[model samples]
Structures are given as structure tokens and as C-alpha cells.
Target chain A: MKSPFIAVSKSEFILYLREPSAFFFTLVFPLLMMLLFASMWGNDPFPGEEYGYVDFSVPAFMGLVMATSFIMSLTTSMAAYREKGVLKRFRAAPATPSSILIGQLSAVFAITVAGVILLLIAGIVFYDLRFLGNFFEFVFAFLLSAGSIAALGFIPASLAPTARSGVVIANIMYFPMLFLSGAALPWFMLPDLMKKISLVFPLTHAIKLMQGVWLGGHFWDYPVHLAVLTGFVFAGLFVSVRYFRWE
Target chain B: MTDNVVTVRNLVKHYKDVKAVDGISFSVKRGEIFGIVGPNGAGKTTTIDCIAGMHRAYSGSIDVLGLDPVSDSIALKRRIGLQQQESEIPDRLRLREAMELFSSFYKKALDWKMLLEQLNLWEKKDSFYSALSGGQKKRLFVAMALIGDPEIVFLDEFTSGLDPQARISIWKLVGNLRDQGRTVVLSTHYMDEAERLCDRVAIVDHGKLAALDSPSDLIAAHGGHTRVYFDASEGFDGKSLSLLEGVESFVNRGDACTLEVNARSAIVEIVKTLDVMGQGLDSFRIEAPTLEDVFLNITGRQVRD
Candidate 1:
């Protein structure tokens, strides 16, 4: 028997492939992002060592891809589907509505995993960035980041009326998180007040977790990021479920 | 009770201040092609919407296959198929894919290839929904509504903007549904169509049912006047037939004069007068009243003012 979830998941993946720009952003852009941001923070930005920016930013780029593909991409596409009565049609059918939703998530899930794998290879080969802490922290952080971003995607999906507006809403959400979460740049150079505000966003927590993993920072730092990301995951998922308009 | 497949009682639906369906009641018999005919905003759509479990009427009881659409919605919905007015299905799906997707909902489904052949959509099997023409889209919709093998189907304005040939093809398709013992509740504004296909019709206007019955019965009751055409035996002007009992209007056409008699009583009087005079009658035929006349009789000659 065919798994029902695979029906929607495979269909969504196939359709998304037809859009060249979305495919590039979800799959290829993360690598470019890793290179550009890694180069900017200094070819070797780690203190007391020669861990290149490629090494430092690779981990951050993993987290960044999770946010863009899982949260931003999922939310925008879902909003467009809602605007076009796609959700409405599913509601009428006894077919797998939830499976279709999960299918859309699966597309993001695959994209994020691919980006993570590429980042891992680049970090190993070029940057020589070692995993100094428990593998579980890195793994746990990866899952949480993906879930948190997926949940947060609901907010923009709820507010954006059309696909175009969804793009704008995502940009409004992403740019600030990119700059402040230390994904685009580190917060160490900012004044204390600016650094304090950055702490509020999940990006800060994602960054802090990865930064801790590299230096083997105390596990205590890991929980704070996890806690923030966990809280956001619940809130974003809840609001998205409550307000998602299917046309 | 056995004869009826659907029964709606005291159906009253209100939206804000306006009553969309006001205290209407009707029943559709099993395996019959029932039509509800009305103009735009005539409450036919609202009435069907309530019956489809899509809307909650303010005060009404709609029972389809002995189940209330609102209260027993899931059970009722599973059995009834609906085609929304101007409903746009999504793109990014093949014609066959759409059929497969919707058919997955039901325990028993019509065969996709069989349905495609019926709609003439088989050759366009690989085409996406957006690539289909308007008639093709309508045919696809009809196909989708039937794919689930619904016992009773509700179609709202099924063929509003189609070329004449497509319209006739759809009417034939609707006829086939009744032949297979499936009940269909159709709503359309086309009078000639309602007359041709409806086993029974509910004529609605201003949110109330103006008349309801078989085509012939409705004509017998409210269809008033049987028009007759005959030569007013020479030397007798059509003017000589002025103000006769049943004759509502008279016009002389060269040798033949047409008379619009008000009732069967007027026809008897006209026949007696013409026969007693012993004048040469050129030609004569009694024209039965149509649904349009019933509409005018009920709504008045003003045409929906």
C-alpha cells in the first residue's frame, strides 16, 4: 500500500522544482550565503586561532537555511495556496489534507537537510571546524531550529493576503533576524543595548548554540537558545493554525 | 416518504437584514431531475448552499436522503455531490490527476477513464486545468461532481455561459443521471432548459417560491391563455373580434390573424363564432403556453422590476 503522506509530499516537491528561482533560493543560495558572510567576518575570525570565517559562518548558515526554507518558504507558499483556494479545495476533499500540509513541510525539510549536508562538507574540507561539544547538542539544535522556523512561518502566512504580499512579509521578517541574530554578522561589535535586543530573537539563540558548540561553551548556553527557540516554535505554530485562512 | 429523496421544510435563511430564502418548502422525488429556476439573486443559490452544509440558514430544516445537512453534515455530505457557481479548481494538476485526487475521498468512485470519455476530456488527459477551455472546465467540473458516485447531486447554474452545442450536450448528460437512478437538484435561469429537462420545477422570485409542479401541470394552472391562429373569415376584420371573453390580444397577419385567448372558455367561444359564420378558415393551431408565460403571469408583465 502507498503511504498517503508520500502522495502530497512527492507532488509538492515535484511542483516546487518547476520554479527555478524558488529552487535556487531553497537549495543553492545557502552555500553562497555561507561563503559571503564567512568571508566578511574575516577569513579567520575565531579568537586565538586560525578558524576561518568559512568555519565560523558555516554553522550559522545551517541555521539560516533552516529559517529561510522551513519557515519563510513554507509560510509564503502556504499563503499563496490559501489565496488561490488550494486549501479550500482540500477541505472539500476527503483526501489527505494534513498529509498535503506535511508534504509542503517535507519540501522544506528536504531543502534544509541538503543545505546542512553541504555546510557540513564545506566546514570539514575547507574550514577544519571541529565539533568540540556533544553531538546531541548539535543534533538537538538542528531539529529545534527547523521546527522553530517552520512554526514561525505561520505568522507571515496568516498576514500575507497574496503570494506577492507573502514575499514582502517574509522580507520584513527575515532581514532584521538575519542582521541581528548574527547570521549576517556577529553581535560582538554592537553596543550593549543592541546586543541585548538581539537576544530576544530566535536567531540569537540559534547562533549562540552553534557558537557554543564550536568553542565547547558550557551546556548552560545551549538551553537558553533552546528555550527561546522552543517558546517561539509553540507560539508561531499556534497562531498559524488559528488564523490560516483557506480563501 | 418513500418517493421523496430530499425534503426541505419552512426554509428561511437570513443574511444581515435581507431574507435570502423565506419560509420556502419543497420535496424532490427519488431518481428525478428536479430543477429550481430563477433569475439572479433569486435565492436559489442560497437555498442550495444551505442544503449543501456550506451555510447555516437562520430558520429552516433541510433533509437530504433523510438527514439534515447541518446537523448530520458528515453523513449527508458524503452522499451529496455539489458543483459551486464559477468555482475555479487549481492549476498544477493534470486533468487525470484532479480526478484521481477527488476520487480518493470516497469509498466507491466512478471510473476516471469512463468519466473522461463521457465529458470528451480524454484526449486532453495531459493538459493542466488552466489550459482547458471554458466548456472543458465546465465539463471537468461536472466530471468531478460525479466522480464520487454521489446518490444525489446539486448543480448551481451548471451551464450559464456555454455555446449552444455544449449546453445541449450538458442537458443530455443531466438526463443520463436520472436514467441511472441518481437524483439531481439543478438550478438554472434558462427557462427553455427548465421546461425541457425538469421532471418538476420550483419557480422562485424575490426569495419565495412562486410556483411548483410538472411543466404541464404548471401550464394548466398558472400558464393562462391558449394562443390560436386562424383567418378571421373574409369581410370580418380582427377588429371585429375586439374585447372577446378569452381573447387577450389579436393581430391580423395578411390572411391569418393570431388570437391570444385568456382561458379555455374563450377558445370555445372563438370556435363557436367562427363555425356559425360559415367563413373559409385559412389555417389554425392552438399554441400551448410556455414557462415564460407562467413567469409573466406570476411576476407580472413588467419583467422583474
Candidate 2:
């Protein structure tokens, strides 16, 4: 007998693989960003610099991968499932909503991890970047951050009545977070107001954790950032459970 | 064990001011095919939703096999299969994949291959949902509903838009469920479907129970008049036709005359009356009352309208 969680996750993974748009966002888009940013700014910023911006930008792109794969993708798919009556059908079946959500979030986590690994490899092979931190610690923080962001995705999914509405809600958070949370730029380059504004988004702490792990910084140094990300996880998950509509 | 598979007492559901299911009560017996027939907005779907634990009735006591539908929904779901009116699978999902996904939800599921074959969809198992025709899609839903080997199945408007061939195939499948001793609760406005498949039907009108009985009994009780039509091969007195023993009224449509008669043996009386009038009956048609007639009689409106 197969566990319902695994069964649902496996099918969700297959569905994620089958969608061309999921392919574009999860794997192709992030890889292109890595290649684009690495080639365009190959050399470092200073006069005597030898390394390009890719060395600094690669970890942020990993954060980008998590957001696209979990937040954007999960929100749109969940809303679409609700709209198509898939969620209601499952409710009528022996499946529990918790199992479905777990399976879906786990699938999203797995796919986003795969995309991140590929991005890291591309950065190493093309731009000569290397992980400077403990591998186990990096993996743990990466997954936790990804799970938190995926929970954030579920909030909009539970609230939106349709896929179009879900996209609208996701984009309102997604583009702004991508720009302000250091995924599209280095954190030090942001103006004071923008940096302060980014503090309110979960993506900011996610990027910070990823960058800290990549740069060999002490994992326990930023307890406040960890707490903020963890807060998002609890809050997002609660809201999703409270508002989800099976029909 | 109780013989009744489902029971609803004083069921009422309100959405703001509209009473979707107002003061309705019915019971479905074990191992029988029960149907709910009503026009659109007549509360058929609302009633089923409440029974299926999808909605909470404002005032009601609903029991399915001795369990409250809402409070014991988890257990109820394990025993009952539901094919909702508007439910659909993902367009990109293949038929086989969908069956596998749904089967995994249960502790012990029916074999997917067997279900596919039973639904006559084995060859299309590998086809994506978007690739299947509308009838095939409906069959796939039926297959999914039965995948868990549920004790009871609820099919809402199961054959609404299918062709005659497809409708007959589904009707046969539903009949098979009854033969296997599984209770089925069907809600549809198709009187012919209810007439053919249901052991008993509850006719609902304007959110209330208008009548409930075996289809034949209801037809016998409420299907008041038979319709008779005859071509006017010769000139006939229209007012004199109304005075015939069984004739309730007569309509003269120039070349033909239509008679609404109150008695089943009115056809014999109509022919005799035509014979005594010295008119040649070039063509005559006698139509017996059907479930549709019963429904029209009770509701005073067509099911579709």
C-alpha cells in the first residue's frame, strides 16, 4: 500500500514536469538568468577585480528559483485545481486536504531543490563559483526557506477564486519581492528606503539565509532573519488552512 | 442494521433569503436506485450537496448508514462515491494517471484496469483528458467514482448532454450498479432516465417535495390525462367531441384535432366517437401518460423551463 502523500506527490511531480510553462519558469528561466548575468558582468566591479557579479548573484538566483517554483507555481496550480473542481473531487474521495497540501508542497520543494542544484552547477562550471559553507547546513537552510516561501504561496491559492485571480495576487507579491529582496540586485546597492521596505517580505530573509550559507557565514548569527522566515511559515500555513475552499 | 441507506428530516438550506432546499424530507433504502427529479433551481443539487457533506443544511437531521453526514464525513466519504455535476480532471492528465492518483487515496481501491474495462475506456487509458470526447469524459468520472469500491454512489445529472447511444450506455451501467446491490442516488431532470433507472423517485418542485413514489405509481396517481390526436379526414363537430365520455377538452387545428382525455380507455372511446360521426380516421395517435406527464402534472411546468 502506497502512502497517500507519496502517491499525490508523485502525480503532482509528473504534472509539474508535463507543463511547458513550469519547465520554462523552474529550470529554463533561472538558468538563463544565471548565464545572462554571468556573461554580461563577467569581471568584478572594482578596477582590480577578477571575479564577475555571478559569484555574488548566484545565491540570490537560488532564492529566485525557490520563489518561482513554489510561490508562483503552487499558487497558480492550486487555484486552477479549485476552479476545475479537482480539489472538490479529492474532498469527496478518501483523500485529506492536509495530505494533498503536504504532497504538493513536498513536490514543489523537490523540484525547486533540483533547479537550485542545476543553477549552482552552472555557476561553478561557467563562472567558477564555489560553495564556501558547510554543505549540510546549506541544504537545511535552503529547504526550510523554500518550505516557508511555498507556504506563502498557499495563502494566495486559498484566497483566490480563479487561476487568473491567483496570478494577479501572486504577481503583486512576486515582482516586488524579486526586485526589492536582492534577487535582482545586490543588497548593498539598494537605497535605504528600498532595503527597509524589503524587510517586510519573506523573500528578503530567504535571500539572506541562502547568501549566508553560500559565503561561509556563521549559520546561527542571524537569529532575527531566521525568526522572520519561520514566522512567515506559521502565518502562511495558518491562513491557507483557515481559508482553503475545497469547492 | 437499518435498511435505509440515507435519511433526511426537515432539511432546509438558505443562501441569504433564497431557500435552496426548504423543508424537504426523503429516505433512500438500501440496495435500491433512488432518484431526485426536479427542474433547474428546484433544489436538487443543494439537497445532494447537503447529504454528501459538501454543504451544511440550516435545519436538518441527515444520516447515511447511521452516521451523520457532516460530523462523520470522513467515514461517510470512505463509503460513498460522488460524481459531481461540474467536477473535472486536469486537462493534461492522462486517463490512466488519473485513475492511479484517485485509487491511491483509498485504503483498498478497485483495480484500475478492471474499472477502465468496466467503463469501456481501456483503450483510451493513455489518452489525456483534453483528448477524450465529452461522453468519454463522463465515463471516466464514473470510473473514478467507483474506484474506491464505495458502498453507495451519487451521480448528479449523470447524462445531461450525451447522445442517445451514450445515454443508453450510462443507463445500462447504472442498472448494473443496482443489480450488484449497491445503492445509488441519482439527481437528474431527465424524466426518461428517472423512469427507466430509478426504483423510486422524489419529485421536487420549488425547493419542496411535491411527490415521492415508485415511478409507475407516481405516473398512475398524478399523470392525469392521455393525449389523443387524429387527422380530420372529414368535417367534424369540435364542441360535440368534448361531450365524449373520456374527453376533457378538444383542440381543432384545421386539418387535425387533438383531444385531452381523462381515462386510459379514452383511446377506445375516441375511436368509437369518430366512427359514429361518420368520419374516416386517416391517422390517429394515442399517447399514454409517462413520468414526464406526472412531473408536468405535479409541477405545472416543464422540467427544463
Highest lDDT: which candidate?
A: 2
List chain A TM-scores, every candidate, in order: 0.87, 0.93
User: What is the C-alpha lDDT profile of model 1 across A1-247, one tens digit per residue?
Assistant: 2344565666667667766777787667777777666555535545786455666666677777877886678767877777776665554444433455566788778878887888778667756666666777667766777777777776776657787888888887787877778776666767788888888778778777776775556546667787888998889867866665555
> Candidate 1 residues B78-175, lDDT tens each?
68788777555557778887777666666677898899999899999889888998889888888888887889988889998889999999999999
lDDT per prediction? 0.76, 0.85
- Interface RMSD (Cα, Å) for model 1: 3.3
Report the C-alpha displacement of residue B158, candidate 1, in angstroms. Answer: 1.1
Native-contact recovery for every candidate?
A: 0.15, 0.65
Which stretches of model 2 miss by more than 4 angstroms?
A43-53, B235-282
Q: Which candidate leads in DockQ?
A: 2
Q: RMSD of candidate 1 to the true fold?
A: 4.2
DockQ of 2: 0.64
